[model samples]
Target: MNDRLTAAQASRSTAVKATLDYPVIDTDVHVNDYTPALEEYVQQYGGGELVDALRKVLGSRFNTRSNGKDWYQQTLAERRYNRTLRSPWWARVTRNTLDLATYTLPALLAERLAEQGADYSVLFPNDVLAPLGAGRHRQALHRAINHYHADQYSKYSDRLTPVAGIPLHTPEEGIEELEFAVKTLGLKVINIAGGVKRPIPSVADKYPAADHPEVAKYAHYTDFYGIDSEYDYDPFWAKVVELGVPVTTHYGSQGWTGRHSISNYMYNHIGHFADGSQAFAKALFFGGVTRRFPGLRVALLEGGADWGAHVFTHLLDRWDKRNREAVHNYNPANADLELLENLFQRYGKDLIKDRTLDKSTLLLDSLGVSALPHSRDPNEDEIDDFALAGIESPEDIKTRWVDSFYFGSESDDRTVASAFNAKLNPLNAKINAIWSSDIGHWDVPDLTEPLAESWDLVEQGVITAADFKALVFDNPYRFYTEANPQFFKGTAIEQKLSSSHTK
Candidate 1:
């Protein structure tokens, strides 16, 4: 064994004794891309043209290229950013995670995980996230990436479950890939981009006018979430329910407006994932996607649990302030015309002569007004308000939001404690904050330290043993099984379960 691996294992032994014997299921482990195999899959799947297009748009190399010339790859400024004062000290302190073998070899990863005190991990692909930038060939490229993952990582099924990448540029394309990835590939987990492309013709003007006018007719930028979305993704959400596999997103909002500056990498990196997760989640809730398909569950990956708490509280707050009866305060139809006329007479100098209020031709009084907020008369049987699903109480909002969403959090985030604190959430509810061991990433230098870092919360009295158990094991198990009851069927987790089925 390598010196680092031995040290990692030794450290894990000390950490595991802190918590009760609960099987850890890390929902956000990542795997390095096997480029040659991915390329082969593209060729076999008749996606050679798509690959060539990707090479032209992005640099040809699959893994991150350190040329210092390519803008998309780490530029000199970004490299310097990683090396300079605060970033450099942080990097040096964190252990080396770039070693290819540590991530590429499944057996090594399994051994490393065991030494880290984790019983199981779900592997996600890094390079596959690139296809979201492509317009024409995204679906084909995602298919190749998914097939490659299934082909490469199936052997590690005992300890690692690989996630299938599915692009959501189009609902039809998403459904097709969903079926292929789940039924055909036998892959269990699904990862979709945080946003989707606007359907053709409607969002045409968002594209650059000069380049490929045909492509320009379609939206080049991705829609942040489904709220007020031009294209309805209800079909895709329904299809996911039918397929019985949960969807997750590790997408980020860096390189976009607020995070676009190149001078500081930290400026772009910090909270980028949370920004994306928040927008996507809020959109899903306000758009009524959760209401339409009650069984649809999504986990936003690697973005900490604190944001989930914030979103849940804010959704309930909005529902309270903007529900049908409450919204009448803002409705023009409910305005007291007589009181407004009296105020205008008392306060108006220039408007009284210019706009004469003839009781015979009073414009405000003459305007058509619905007694109900959204065209439904209050006297009728049903009220058609802005909130379509008729969220009667705050508990309804809490139930819908909490049930439909799960937040995947890194072990080290200080804010993760908010997820466990009922006082911090709406309706005194607990948000689903599943543990994400981000083992292969730079944030966790030593793979074995994640469990130790997470236990710090319990040590500090921020959360309880029950909260830690749910965060590390129960929540993730429930999310995966909510989609597929057989998710832990033959895995080590199944054997550890006191009951045959997941609770």
Candidate 2:
């Protein structure tokens, strides 16, 4: 035999060296959305009109800006630019389109996983998520894409688990899709968009008037922070808890309105996932969804764990100061009008002569007596404020914010170590940092890089081996298995998990 070893052999050797007692489960791996049979599924689900709509909606020139592009007569260069932008850098670097086989081929992907020493991976769709939108065709679109995703991983279910995409524009639709995907499709994990679009004037009022000026073709999508959301969405959360599938959001703020600078993709990409996940987590916590659905688990995918740590501390900081009781201190009613008047008269005799300081205008317009705090009880209105939902102590924040949510961190992220830092997190508690390799995407050049990069934390003394184990394996295991204890029942690591539990 030759003394030389293949690249796969070398990667396998490296993975063996870094092996942990627990199996590594990557929570956010992506799969290619463009299958040869995608259109077939679309047609089968009565999404022929949606296919026509998609064909009519011309693709964006910039990969960063996808919404509201002219649907007709797009230039060839624009299409070429978008396609080039979306392709992986490795393919460009190697100048070989076949490098994509690592993602496209199930055998190759499994080999790569074995080389990385990862026991399992949860697959997400990149392009499919964008098209799974709301409206008349939502159910059909959701069904088709979910069916395709299930088919993609059907044979590879031993090592790969595809997350079922469920739309949340309506609770009834969301519930129906969840049930169908889990029961009929036999999908174990479910993924949903962290945010929703608030159709202005509600879907009911807008539908009656098709030609109305207010009725735009696209609904004004907003962050679901619950501060301004039109829907309660408690029923959806209840369904998630009822079904035993841990909910994950691969949603990000990539091609949205604010991030729509046509110049640079990096400008739109930085911290986009973090922003989306933070908004969703905050909405769930402040809206009292977590309090109501205590058993519910949410994993914010592709965002680093640092956001989780920051958002948790930030919420407490805001809650400590922004409560109705604390805000009452700043009530305009508390301002002494008489004292201010005396000071104004003493300090501004020249201004009075010039008619600069108008007392009536100042009181009526600037600090109106009619809008005083005494006019309405703060306690009575406190119930209306979603942020003040029975939030008495740190326990509430810890339970609702910390325990209920898990952060999906890519292996290549340096900030992954921060999730394990007790000092950075609140109450010396750790945020659940689930390992998400994102192997098929541009961020990871090599399929094996994610696991190797994550081990850098251990080599740098950023985290202990035990901490790294939790980051890669324990946290992911807990996130999924806690929702459905039989999550790994037939998987490769069921024995190891069982042994650990027995011990």
Candidate 3:
């Protein structure tokens, strides 16, 4: 075998050995574009020219060009923001290549599991959710994508678990899609964009609103929103509690327009997109979704963890004051405080009250946060310190900074080995942190580097090996399966895989 292959095998063997002891499950991995497989479905159900136009627009925004010698591929950034548009040579030599399947199923999955030593990898589509919020043929597009994914999941049932995507243009459609994903596809998880895009009539133009109350019924399938919110999602909280499904949201593709004057410029700005994800998530948390559904577990993907620590603390303080002020405003004779306390007690009865919020008078407890480890790509080197703050309180941010550093390294051996060997105090609640590879994006293809980097953190005494395993495996399995017993059962996984492949 080649040197690279040999190293990869060794890594896989090591991962398997580790998992045999701890049972590692990777919560966030991805399956890239299945357009070819779903072409038939698209032809039958998909909108034509508009979809093509959409693809062209998105592709132009991110696609890269290769030089004639096949030696170097230039990404969108390298094109000098489309400097090629002015060149006559561009049309002849430059072709926009958007290859979603750079990492094929069997090969990529096998390699990743072997490299990371994960027992199972929860797979999602890299492009699907981001595009749905555009509100054009959202339902049909989602159906076609899910059908394609279901087929792939069946093909590699042994290693891959697929989370189906649901369209939420209408509340009823969201509910229907959820039922279908769980019952027919056996999808334990449903991937949702945090906000829905609906056309709103205005004096000048019609635009989309990120937060909409009508979208909440879909929460019955999963409580997670792409962004965190306090208002306009109460029905969602109610349904989530009733159904008991944890929500997983990730950062990518905001369904927004008008931020940039240039259409192409808006699409190319990664920072703008990240900001939108952060903003939407903040809105949800401060808006009180967690307070409403305290039992709910929300997992943020791609977006790093540092901001979560800062935001959670800030929100808690705000809510505490809000509760106290409300109490003061009530008349003593009316027993307003007592009535409010009784309601709080009633809500607490159903919510999983975390110790962090026990002393606070606010109704909602703090939900946990998961961090995405830094990318393995040497080109992408900067690790955000903000993510490291996620595991600790805001006051402890400085003293506990070391812990965050230890937890988020890209080296798997250092992170996992050290975590395994470390003497962890049970009082810390086992970190409740997990790693998502953000695979299938145009950028990240393999888990080897990220997993290895995480391990390096462990080996360097940054995080304990136990925490490494929890980040990679244990927590995700518990997160999805624990919320809904029927969805995560072994039979469901196997049956879903079998059915998809047979098609």
Candidate 4:
């Protein structure tokens, strides 16, 4: 055994696992991409044209080439003109070469996961762009990538299971790949991009991004399937439900709105996964995807548990203040115009000194409820925002948000406490927080420390021993089983659970 692997076996994480009666499942271990092998597989399956397309992956958070020039090659003038958002550089572990090699080689990873105190791991490929990027050749590339993963890692399936990536730029493409990946490939877990970038109508009309890529980047919006999407996507969701695989996303919002930092990668990087997942998850809630499909089991990964807990509490709070009945409290048509005029007249003088009160429009604008005078009443279908969600009470919010959605969290995020805090969360429901030890990435310098650090939460009184069990085991098991009850069958986790039950 390598020195590092030996040391890892003797680490505290393994010690912590020794104390546990249940198995430890690491849901989000990443496999660093060996691009040359991937390229070879693409060349074989997709041919040279698609292989060349795969080679042009810009190595950004997603896989779009910036027209011609790479980011570093750009002159300041070009950067200012094109406005390229910062991308990740030097993202993998280097000094600990063996640890890096362990994840890259499935056999080594399978051998070492026990040292990391994990009984089984679901491997998300480090290169997500090929399976989730937009292009003519993407469907072929996605197939080639998933095929390569299935071929390369099947032997290690006893301990290490690689997740298949399904591109959802269109419902047709998503359904095609989903059928192929699950039915043909026999892959269980699936990773999906949270959203797809679509060109704005006016911007694309004049400067079509197909002709000018800059126009697409600068003038675009994301379509997160569940809300404001061009496609209904119910068929894709239904197919997922029919197949019984859990949905996992490692989506990043690197260049979106406030995160578009032209100078610093860190500014664009932090909380990006959380932000992207938040938008996608929130879209599912408000767009009524969860309400419509009660069997859907969605997990938003890498973003911490704190964000999930916050979203759950906030959902209940919003429902409390903005549900169908409560929203009418501030309806403009119901406003007491006489009382407002009296109060403004009494407290006014300075405010009214500037505008004429004869202008009821200007007076009402100053009073802060000025979108009205009946430009048009909303259609009956659009009356209540929460109508689609079917949220009659906070319990419904708990069922939809808390029960259906799972948050993929790292070990050291202090906010695991918030996810477990039933006292603070509305309706005393614990937000599902699953441990996804992003071991191969830069954040976790040591491979074996994640499980140990999670145990530290119990020692620090951040959560109970029961909460730690839920974080590392129960919640993740439930998430994996919610859609497909047979998700863990024949796997190492199933054997471990069966052994515990038999004992």
C-alpha lDDT values of all predictions: 0.73, 0.71, 0.48, 0.84
Predicted candidate 3 versus true structure: per-residue lDDT over 59-139, tens digit per residue: 543332333211125454545443322111121111112113224544555554656555567777665564464445566
Reference-based lDDT, residue 420, model 4: 88
RMSD of each: 6.4, 5.5, 16.4, 2.8
Candidate 1: TM-score? 0.80
Of 2 and 4, the candidate ranking higher by TM-score: 4
4, model 2: CA deviation in Å? 16
Candidate 2 lDDT, 396-499, residue by residue in tens = 88888888899988876888777888887778988899888887777766665678788887888878788888888889999988898888888877866778
For candidate 2, the lDDT comes to 0.71
Error of 3 at 24 (Å): 1.6
For candidate 3, the per-residue lDDT at 310 reads: 38
* Total clashing pairs for each candidate: 2, 1, 45, 0
The candidate 1 region of ten consecutive residues with least summed lDDT is 84-93
Residues 169-233, candidate 4: write the lDDT tens digits: 88898899989998998888899989988888988899987798656667888899986788899
